[model samples]
Target: MSCSCSSSTNTQNELHASIMQKINNHPCYSQDAHQHYARIHVAVAPACNIQCNYCNRKYDCSNESRPGVTSYKLSPEEAVKKVLHVGGLIQQLSVVGIAGPGDGLANPKQTFETFSLLKKYAPDIKLCLSTNGLMIHKHIDEIAKYNIEHVTVTLNSVDETGEIGSKIYPWVFYEHKKHRGVEGAKLLLEKQLLGIQMLVERGILVKVNSVLIPGVNDEHLPFVARKVKELGVFIQNVMPIISKPEYGTKFGLDGVPSATHKQLMKAQEACDVNVKLMRHCRQCRADAVGLLGEDRSDEFFKESFADKSFEELAHHYDLNQRMKTHENIETWRRALRAANGKINQEEATNKDELSSNGNTMLVAVTTRGNGLINDHFGSAKEFLIYEAGDKAIKFIMHRKVENSYCMGKENCNGTYPIEEIKNALSDCHLLLTQKIGDCPQKELESIHLTCDESFADEPIEISVLKGVRKHFFTAS
Candidate 1:
């Protein structure tokens, strides 16, 4: 009963009809769908039963951007209204869900209440819920009752001996009893697996989110991936653990280092499961708004729209306009896919372009996907990593950015983590994007990296091949 994926990447063309329909516009589930769709999370759940070594929930932490952190926690009533207001403004907004400042299932009353109201009001927007999986077995019937088609379970480890889980999660509270050590770990694992199976049986799409913690569960995730895939799980997202010292979590305080881009890719490559690896995750905040990696929660506070009714905000939701916008996006995407197909024919020729006596280096590309260098450097959330040289031009993997260089006019102060971006691309020789401001261009140049915008609308592989030759093959 496993999906028929020939490779690790999931393509709309290869997806089954049922799976495709569920992920067509869900940003979290589909790699391609994310480029054109938007999603939002309402922080209605504020209780958790299990304590992880890497978590320290910060309610009203406006500066730090990560899961278990939110600027405000809204009641079920306020949450439904926020959805209506945001859905009207962002025509591309397709999914609304509750991902926590705490575990959603732990606060079942608030979680289901939010679902009931959103179901009653904004039926067109798909419903998503993320939880710890400790309570899912207890409430699968109610979840089915609400018709929640999408669910995310955070299953960090799959070690049956509970050794790996003991390192990641310290304790668990179930059925009014607190358990610690290996016992707690085993109980949590059993519940998570059972709940995931129940969800699959009910025909619900399940996405397993596992944090890649170094020395803790990094070596154990391959087993986790295989187990979930065997259990009819839809997809598996392997995310890097964020353990900043300021977050005050156990790992952060104990000086456990955060996973680097290279380490994450290595773990992902090591897994090699048929289940798709999600490379676009930004490790979004619990109450995140707007597209991936971009948080605009501050823009739509309760005080900002306290007087607006659901009907008043709902009036602005334009189905016709959304349809038109999506149509335009689809047209360009189709062209992009056609162009990228050239890789099959052109790749054979490029493999030995400079094989005998040429230098090889890594190059980073910024694109919104259409086989074109169309995304601006400051706005790109990911850099498509590729290996290029006289020998060949091949895509290796993608690297995700924690933040974008540009937010907007009022917030664009030219000091948006330029150094961080530089470090992320340090090994690469060149960066290709639609455009970049002089400030970043100069910063990147200081690291001996060249930035080019000349191939703004050109096909990615062809442009990359040419750019590599022009810099390394030609006489200066």
Candidate 2:
């Protein structure tokens, strides 16, 4: 029983200037939006000690813990009724993270009893947490006695002098042996830079999620953004290593970094400093919640743990009673083949030959600016088509604007001409644009030389391409 925060330097600099103006008006860091989607992670502590080969505590290790992944383990009165049923169906619940299947201070009694029942029932909820500072210097007084205001620390390398943080976090259990490589990444980067300099000298706002990993720590992300901006760490989320070949893990088994928009704006201009690089991170889970890319986890699993009706939990998981039809593309391909099963028969026959060839698949879904598409016929609207083979096509563009062109840049008016996105892929010979650029993939392969071999060069994990097109082409 210890959680208190109110030093009130004008209410912690107006809550760190309204969370750095919502992380510079997020769309996952301003691609003006194309799905960096978030909606509170909801698996409380399954278990994790430390072993990051690109994580696999069975699939809940927002930091560590792996095995068949399904630790609901709920109760702080079932997580404050799933955070007021996901804060009345989300607009900005902002953040309430634990970041686990494990390690919210290594599940400190279900992470401080779910942040003391969301500060005694959702006290204007906004408490983000993520850890790997191996039990964050013994729960910095239960995360400043629960005034917990956003802390992410997955410091891939503060000192394990590379080789991908010594082949992904070699081992760290501390005082109980199991300390390998750069002696357990220099004792977990010296207790995560002494819990990020005691949560930025107790102002309580720090972010540093570095996972980069191309040739391991892409030259150590500007030395991990100049050592978490000399421990003041306002933000630095350099993520991109979610390597999963069914969790064998050598860090997402090479070849995921297509890294364009001029290589993530030249690694955010070579991490010049003054931290802040979170570009709308969907490296989420550990009870994630809405308003970055919007998931609202089935309206917080039907108003906090099912009273029923997402068509009665999709007819009790027979799943696909038109997936309760709303965010369609067959309701995001039947909720990504029921949360990761199968759906990529060349993106379900390029959405059935663009709906048997009437040809209209325009999705623009913007969050804004440095989130990258870099103009390719950009008035963005078409919306439906999915049959990636009989002449190749997979269009799902949706951005008429609903908040995140880095949070409405003076109503973002600009984009569309690589010739109007190759004249909307000129009645498709092949085109599957889920955010592409390298100068619009050499101007859409010089106008359709099979539009970069029918997409999926990357960024199509909408639940492992709907579980590899529902267990190999819509259940045969």
Candidate 1 ranges with C-alpha deviation above 4 Å: 1-15, 342-362, 367-418, 436-450, 457-476
Instruction: Report the Cα lDDT for candidate 1.
Output: 0.81
386: Cα error in model 2, Å:
12
Each model's backbone clash number:
1, 71
lDDT of 2 by residue, 55-104 (tens): 65553233322222333445445665565555444433434666676666
Each prediction's whole-model lDDT (CA): 0.81, 0.51
**TM-scores, one per candidate:** 0.84, 0.32
Q: What is the lDDT of residue 10 in candidate 2?
A: 64
110-183: candidate 1 lDDT, tens digit per residue: 99999999888787888999988998999999899998999999999888888888888889999999989899
lDDT of 2 at 326: 20
